[model samples]
Target: MTDATARPVRSSPRPTGTPLRAFGALMLRDTRVLSRELLPFIVRVIMQPLLFLFVFTYLFPRMGGGNGMMMGGGSFATVLLPGLMAVAIMFTGIAAVALPLSTEFGVTREIDDRVMCPLPVYAVALEKICFSALQCIFAALLVLPLAYYIPSTPVLLHVSSWPVFVAVMILASLVSGALGLTIGASVQPRQIGLVFSIVVIPITFLGCVYYPWALLSHVRWLQIVVLANPIVYMSEGLRTALTPGMPHMPVLAVLAGLVGSLAVLGTIGVRNFLRRVIS
Candidate 1:
């Protein structure tokens, strides 16, 4: 017979750890995987900008006997410097999250296993965005030094304010990550290529990457129209910080656009992620 005074022992708490710990662990795992794929990652980030710079800034000038002038009068490479960085950031973010995520959400349903971590489902989504943002940062930085070395003509980059430069880099990276999440969640695996063809190409061509927004006076309607593209702000914002001697959008508008884009995209991505997971 059990002793009358003996009480039932309480069970121990779960060893699952806190949500933040799980979130960090998820990111760490992704980081480890990325470390193994370093060669491919470097190749993917550098190829587009390197080839474009080689052709346009180096070969084209030698072929054409001159370079195109930017809006406020600078070498094409000057314009391309910030613009290419922006593209790298945007493309890296999309590739980091959207491409793999589409496959995970496909027949594999690998995303289900990821969401089953002890952390909240939204935290899992946030992990994707945050890690993608980090890759965006790295891809963008890789583009930065290339501008100095790649162009036969000088790529003039004058950073008047380091704080502003850093801030734009961060906000723009996050915006791209959020945009990636939205794309990843909305587009099925089969349809993602279509997204790049229709959505991404159009936006990039129209995003004022090769020119300044202020120079669009000749095409006022098109200028007004392209403002709707988040990439416009990124290119413009970077142009402002990196090439201050050149004309750029108002600082207020750049900051506002980045903030607004982040908010809108983040909300939509989280909602779509939740719906996809729950359904």
Candidate 2:
């Protein structure tokens, strides 16, 4: 006999939207947030590159410091323009991913909300990387015209091959984004400032932003050591594609190194992100 007091069981309904739809919604939300902060974003994007161009490319040259002079008669502005663009890409990529990640993993705990969304954990990581890459590309584009024209020293930008140029830019952005993801995942919030001091400073100065990698041939040990830096490949790749006459790393080597970095760093970053979220 059935009991008169028996209660009915209720089952939760399954979530309706496709994973792609969820991913799109998340991306759209992020895009809106980014748009609202566009003015600050533009300031952050333009400040360092503009100053670097102003000081080294314009002020110093006008003051007779011969800032535009390089060994073998290469234009310093030409060499610097690519490196500046690389710096823009790298800095923007890293900051875009890392800063918010620090907050998300800290007091705000916003990442918890993201992880709760109907998406795979790895998809969240991929979203961060793709968004950061887009920001890096935008930063690069914005910096290019300013770097080209603002410098009192004339910059000779001769695109040897559009395909190669585009390839380098794309790869550079991906590598920087991957690097940001890895760093953001690995570092604790308290140590973020220290990471910037120790990791980022060395990367910027040693990345060959102010000079061509070929100049380092005289200092063989230094040249070999700086090769470990991803920015070397990025700067040299730009130099190779943009100003062919400048002595830069071999194109094949740059491509191979960037691809390897993307593979290793992207994997590690996603794994770390998953662990962070799950924990």
Candidate 3:
């Protein structure tokens, strides 16, 4: 063969901007997938929060005069609104990321495609977080009206610290997403039900969904246990932002702990997920 014919043709170098473009495309693709699968996720996210709203905001106010503000001290509805909204974000993050992750890692082996993407392993994990965080925002909006209408007492919906509220909302979603990643990577697909029964229940009860960490002082030991719960920080942080008058954990301390814990847990989850995929 001639020297020219023997030489192999080289393709143009891959685009230098491929990573950003790919990341955006990946985000949009996941968003479309989530949109199609949204109904069940929405239902699951809203159900438990709604139940708590009705029982505490609607029922308890009439029966016990607590309305929604931490067993009758503050505006029960107002207090529960932010706290429960935080809880809903937590649930949405878990349901959107964790449950499907187990399935993808198990029955479907669908995560293999994600691993094959040109992005770093962390990008795949980040995609999960981004997808679930979007759901968290949606769930928060869906439950806001309930927060407004359900309480018997005159409830406030102050947003004096709009920036803080938004920041805390994002923080709450990140914490939940990190927790979901850890749980998703740690559990077997068949054992996810066990997570719901044990992990989810304990987190919801101990997470300050119904009361602030301050009120838990009466049960000091339980308080310590729940103080370790990320949800407590998220709930308290959110409540503080929404209700300026409500007492809460020191914002700096709670935010620091939550962000730090999420970093640690999320690192472990990424390592675990990468190992699982490669194996």
Per-model C-alpha lDDT, please? 0.90, 0.86, 0.79
What does candidate 2's lDDT look like per residue over 1-279, in tens digits? 999899888898766876788888888888999999999999999999888888877887888866565643576778888888899999998998888888898977789999778889899888888888888889988988886688877787788988878888889998898889998998998998999999998998999887888899899999999988888888988988988888888899989978887898899989998888888
Candidate 2's displacement at residue 176, Å, is 1.0
| Decoy 1 TM-score against native | 0.95
Query: Which candidate would rank higher by TM-score, 1 or 2?
Result: 1
Candidates' TM-scores? 0.95, 0.91, 0.91
Which pairs of residues clash in candidate 1, taking residues 3 or more apart in a chain or in different chains? none
Q: Between which residue pairs do clashes occur in model 3?
A: 61-67, 68-76, 68-77, 69-76
Give the least accurate 10-residue stretch of model 1, judged by summed lDDT: 64-73
Instruction: Give per-residue lDDT, candidate 2, residue 227.
Output: 81
lDDT of model 3 at position 154: 64
Model 1 Cα lDDT, one tens digit per residue, 42-149:
999999999989888888888877764444678888887888888898999999999988998999799999988898899898889999999999999998777788
| Winner by lDDT | 1
Candidate 2's TM-score reads: 0.91
lDDT of 3 at 72: 32
What tens digits encode model 3's per-residue C-alpha lDDT throughout 1-279?
578758688998998977767778888998888788778767877787788878877887678654344543576677677778878888888887788899899867989887677888778888788777877888888887776676677667677677778878887788788778888988888998999998888888888877777887899999888767888888888878877677678778777867886888788878877777777
